[model samples]
Target: MKLLIIEDEKDLSDSIRQYLALEQYTCEVAYEFESALDKICLNEYACIILDITLPNGSGLEILKELKRQGKEDGVLIVSARNSPDDKIVGLNLGADDYLSKPFHLPELGARVAAIIRRKSFSGQNQIVIDHLTLDIRDKTLKNNEEAVPLTRKEYELLLYFVSNKNRVVTKEAIVTHLWGDDVDMADNYDFIYSHIKNLRRKLAEAGCPEYIKAVYGMGYKFSIPS
Candidate 1:
């Protein structure tokens, strides 16, 4: 899953990123409100870890903007205060969950996972389509009864494709989702082509159907006809 950490504390953000990286999540960080807003407006995310206090603006304002835009991205509010009003307001503004500072990293990770599941999978941990079964909690993909071995990037690619099934996903979207802000510095997205190629090869070798389609001059689409 992809997450955006909108936190002012660099140390806390880094720690969160490091911990979540072990869980195979793609993380991007923004320690200020403007940067966070830039990212929020530009890209899509599975979940956003938003701090109530920011240097330039209140994170509550960010939550309000999200609601105003009718964005469906799951949000987990992180605040040091234990104020009930804050929690109530955040929840009222469509924040999925609230977390106090000095929290356990594992618990935070679990909450993020749960929110992603709730929003994307209708509270289910696994997604089944056609002959393929994807266990999000276990990070496993199976073609019928046979398991498909995929690298971390390949697995993430597949999940991204599944999340936007039947839609033409642009190369820029793929690069930003996989590499985060680093795509600005990178020259080309050839690596994405490689990942897609490898994932397709592995899935086909495992006898799965050809579901990923490349849209001419646009990008790629992962679709299955009814």
Candidate 2:
């Protein structure tokens, strides 16, 4: 999954990123309001970890912008403030969950997973599509009860495909979703084509139907055969 961490505390944000990275999530961080606003407005994420306090402005305003844009990215508000009103206001402003600071990292991870699951996977930890089964918690996929080992990027690619099944997704969109701002360093999309090819080969070797389809010059689409 992809996540945006909008926290002012550098140490805390780094810690969160490292911890979540071990769980196989690609993370990007913004330490202030303007940058945070820029990211949220420009890209999509599975969940956003937002702090109510920021260097330039209140994070509540960011929440307002998300609500105004009708963005469906799951949000978990974290603040040192324990006030029920703050929590209430955040929840009312479209945040999916509230976390008081001085919280355990595991708990935060759990909450992030919960928000992603509730929003994207219909609150299920497992995604079953045809003969393929994906275990969200462990980041594993199975074909006909046999384990299908995938590289981290490949697994993420599959999940992204499954999430947007039947819709054509541009290579640019895929790059942004998978690589975040790091795409600026990439010279071309050869790596994306490589990942797609390998993923297709693995699924085919496992006796699964081909789901990912190239849409000529446009992009790629993932769809079950009817």
Candidate 3:
């Protein structure tokens, strides 16, 4: 999933970004309010980690703007403020969860996962498509009674495709989502083909029907024929 971290504290922001990145999440950061607003306007994020206090503007304004635009992205308010009023105001303004400063990074990660689950998966722990079953908490994929082994990238690619099943996903979008901003300067997207090919082969070998389809020169789509 893609995440936006709107934090003015450089150290804390960096820590969160790095930790989340290790968990296979694409994360971007804005140290100030304007940059954060620009990113929100430019990209679609699964969630936004917002700090109530900003140097130039309040994070509450950003939350309001997101709501005004009908953006469904999850918002988690992270602030040093610990007052009950602050929590109430944030939740009322559409924040999914609140995290105080000095919180554990793992706890923040768990909260983000919970919010995404609530938003995208209807609070379910497993996602089922055809004969394939994906365990979200354990990060495992099963076909029938057996486990299917997938590399980290392969697993992430599968989840991405399933989450956006039946929609054509551009190679650029997949690369950016998997590799983050560092993929911008890549020479070609051949690596994407390689990963997709491997994932397809693996799934097929495990007795799963081929669900990934190439859209000519466009992109790829995941679908199970009805």
Give TM-scores for every candidate, taking all chains together and pairing residue i with residue i: 0.96, 0.97, 0.92
- Worst 10-residue stretch by lDDT in candidate 2? 203-212
Model 3, residue 75: displacement in angstroms? 1.2
Which ranking of candidates, highest lDDT first? 2, 1, 3
Error of 3 at 120 (Å): 1.4
Candidate with better lDDT, 2 vs 3: 2
The whole-model lDDT of each prediction reads: 0.91, 0.94, 0.88
Which model scores highest in lDDT? Answer: 2
Please provide, for model 3 over 1-226, each residue's C-alpha lDDT reduced to its tens digit, 9 standing for 90 to 100. 7889999999999999999988778798899989988888766777899999998999999998898888989999999999999999999989999999889999999999999888877888899877878987788899876899998889889888977888999998888777765777789999999999999999889877879999998999998775
lDDT of 1 at 49: 98
Off by over 4 Å in 3: none
Model 3 reaches what TM-score against the true structure? 0.92
